[model samples]
Target: MKERETWKNGKEFLFSCIGVSVGLGNIWRFPYICYRNGGGAFLVPYFLFLAMVGIPQLLLQFSYPQYSSSGPAKAWVCCPLFKGIGYAMILTNSAVAIYYNVIIAWTLYYLVNCFTLHLPWSSCDNIWNTENCYSRTYGLASMTGNTSSYNTSIPEDQNLKTNVTLSSNDSKTATEEFWTYNVLQLTDGIETMGTLRWQLLLCNFSVCVIVFLCVFKGIKLSGKIMYVAATVPYLFLTILLVRGLTLDGALMGLRYYFIPRWAELLRPSVWFDAASQVMYSLGFGTADHIILASHNKFHHNMYRDAMIVPVVDAFTSLFSGCVIFVTLGYMSSTFQLDIDKVVTDGPGIAFMVFPEALSTLPFSQIWSTLFFLTLLMVGLDSRIVQVQVLTGSLGDLCPGLFRSRVSWTSAGVCLVAFVLGVPFVYQGGMYVLQLVDWYIASVAFLLIVLLESSVLAWLYGSHRLSEDIAVMIGYPIPKFWQVFWRFITPCCILVVWVMGLVKHKPVTFGGQAYPAWSVGVGWIISLVPLMPLIGNIILTLLKHEGNTMQRLQKSIKPLPEWTKNLRSDQNSEQNGDILL
Candidate 1:
């Protein structure tokens, strides 16, 4: 076998980390989480956790790949028993990559339609719009009790409560109808497969092609693409922020975002949300950090990279929140609605609310096009990292399969991802996306992180790991970081895990409960990645050449491939001091 490839330089690795760490979550999830928790008060816990838990955990994971010079799966070579963590990461990432592309396809679908002089989502005249479709002016007028009369012609069978009607007080906005009826063509529930969405399938195929071309040459081409991908989103964000601040009620939105409700600090859920957000936003436990750092030169300053990436991610989240809330503030003022009514998180904010707000702006088409394009770019950067994690890990494990023809291997991976994502293009696909997202992306992620920390800090020894990191970075490891990694961070993770389980609620979409079978399937998806870990333990006990205790100890021993020079140096230095 041949030697593995390292990043050409530190900048390429930094940009790649930025591309992976800063993702759609920062744009969509963080703002809403802030708004939902305690507005400005949420930042207290967020920053606290970022310092105590986020950066330390990130540094811990970051050091492994660079020190071992291997992907997440292979990075566990030191303690082969926990190697399942790497396999679990691969499984989790593969599942995420499949559904995540579906979102990119949705963004592409929206982006393509954004070119017209009259935005499709701005008017209620389309086939998807119902009799109840209302403009911002109409909504504001309705809120003020000066509602205009309009024809309400509808069949009794279609007179459902959820259906928006002109006669009803609650009417659906054009953008809402566009997202639900036009873009998604969503079914009533997950039980129905409905029909394939041809448009979305085409977009998904296009996304696959774009991803393949960008990374087909591996990091050589991808590293250069990272320069554009990592930096362009900020430019787009700055433009949106300038435009958003100029809108009426922009101050009110900012007030809602930063003005803390001090009482919320007492709530445990707020603290939990803050901790969870740090983990999610920082890309910890996803193994993307490990895989990306693995490509860095052996002596690169990953300690510095870890610190820089999380700070950049937090800044991006704050910047994105400002941009989003400014638009939402305008939406609220235009409709004479409260900020809470106008604000939403996840796909609702990105696909529905933001687009609705954009329709009312001057040069609506231009702004709308830019907004969706921004989404496409952010999603594209994240998707590239996810693809890299899978391909990189596989390349590490099976060199023969990928080494001779890296481009072919990459194309094959993209094709498989596209095929796996097809079910999400069906009318009921959104439900599948929601199910997988809720189960795999939340508690499962934290559990994986907790296990990884335990194995590394306790089993592998944080002191030894610190010595390795110090040697690589040419600096002494901070005392606080050592304490955080060995104790504080793990305790914090356990608390968050327990809190999440206590507050766990059944997954729902549009306030509708999922069928039991679908929920069962979701749980199954969550456990699938964990299967390897369980199997590895059982096999270690059964197959190893020793008694139970001895076999268990043997399983955790460092592999011969783990770098031994640093540990040997530490030992030699100690012996030399004793001799003196």
Candidate 2:
């Protein structure tokens, strides 16, 4: 077999992992989840779950690739029956990648418009605006201290101190109209996939080209790019936070973000949301981190990398909350609305609320450009890593076909992913995006994480994994990690998954639930990725020449080659030839 490529140093691997961890979700998803769960009170469960669930699973994922010197799929030599765990990882990440770039395309379209003297979404006079459209900027400029005509019963004694007038019940802000009409060109339902939006198609194609160029040369070039792509978003966040703090109601938003609702800690859903957020923001149970660590030098300190990456991810999510809520707080104070009134869920916070907030700022065009640029960079960082995961996995699985042609592998994956993503740029694409994201990214992802934890900690053996980590890092894992890996993490994941399933509602957009047919399609999208696990089990049982129980026991045993490289390293360590 040809030698697998390794990173020049551990720093490259760390940065690559961090780039994937601190993705667009930290900016858009985490803040809203944080605020909704408990305002400031949510941190209790968030950090609790992070410690109990996130770090342990991260170590498990990190350890396998580092020890095996292979991608997620190929690393499963430890327990070949569970190799399907790796397949599930790849499929889930691939499903995410398909629709994710369309978001980057949306950001690209917005970034281009940011260069204009006047922002397109600033007024109601745009061609996309309807008779019900009311300009948020116009309202902001026209009514300073004037009381809003919109009916509200909240007393003036409240914390926000609402005094300004708001648009009526029927009014949609220019920001809203632009997002729904101009950018998305949204149809009423998923059944009506209208004509392609040529502008967005071109933008999505550009995203594909950019991703291809960055990754086609392999990790050396991409690793160098991470030096910038991984860290620059921090600079943008700091800038936005500083600017947001200066606004009148910025403190109000900050309070909403950090102030703990102690009572919320009693809610099962609050804890579940926190656990799920840790999984989402930290990029757990994904192939990208495995591929990233697989490139590290054999003796590199992944225990440290695992620790630092999750910390940075959590900090970025917290910092982004400051940036988002302060702007939200300002919007509330400006429009004399409560914080809850101003806040929105899902992508609305990114494409609508934040854009409207930026429009209210002085030098709105400059700020808008910076914000979308941040989104573009963060989204691109994640996209490159996802491509790396797919390409690297294919190379690992079929070295002969891809061994000398890594670039070709990358190009083909990017081309195929881009083509699949094209449907998202259609007029009704947002609906399809919502449907796929709801099913493919949610429950299926939880199941993948649960399966990995069980197989690695139980089936493959936690004590063995700890010994493997000690081999690479020069020390054994703490008892806490071992205990959590074998028991606590799995229990927490099961509770969260079950609770989420019980509370689950049909996926909806703009207050409208998807049709029954579309819901079925969503289920199929989620279920197809999980088929490998069942199929592999039946195959393993049939292939082994033994009784059912004996076959099951034999299937879980490590292959002879599983620790071949590790034994060589152990011998070298005993000879004092290998040093950590």
lDDT score for candidate 1 against the true structure: 0.83
Instruction: Give the range where candidate 2 is weakest over 10 consecutive residues by summed lDDT.
Output: 157-166
Worst 10 residues of 1 by lDDT: 145-154
Against the true structure, what is each candidate's TM-score? 0.92, 0.93
Which pairs clash (backbone N, Cα, C closer than 3 Å) in model 2? 40-258, 40-259, 40-260, 41-259, 41-260, 41-261, 148-165
The C-alpha local distance difference test score for the whole of candidate 2 amounts to: 0.83
Clashes of each: 1, 7
**CA shift at 515, candidate 1, in angstroms?**
1.0
Local distance difference test values of all predictions, in order: 0.83, 0.83
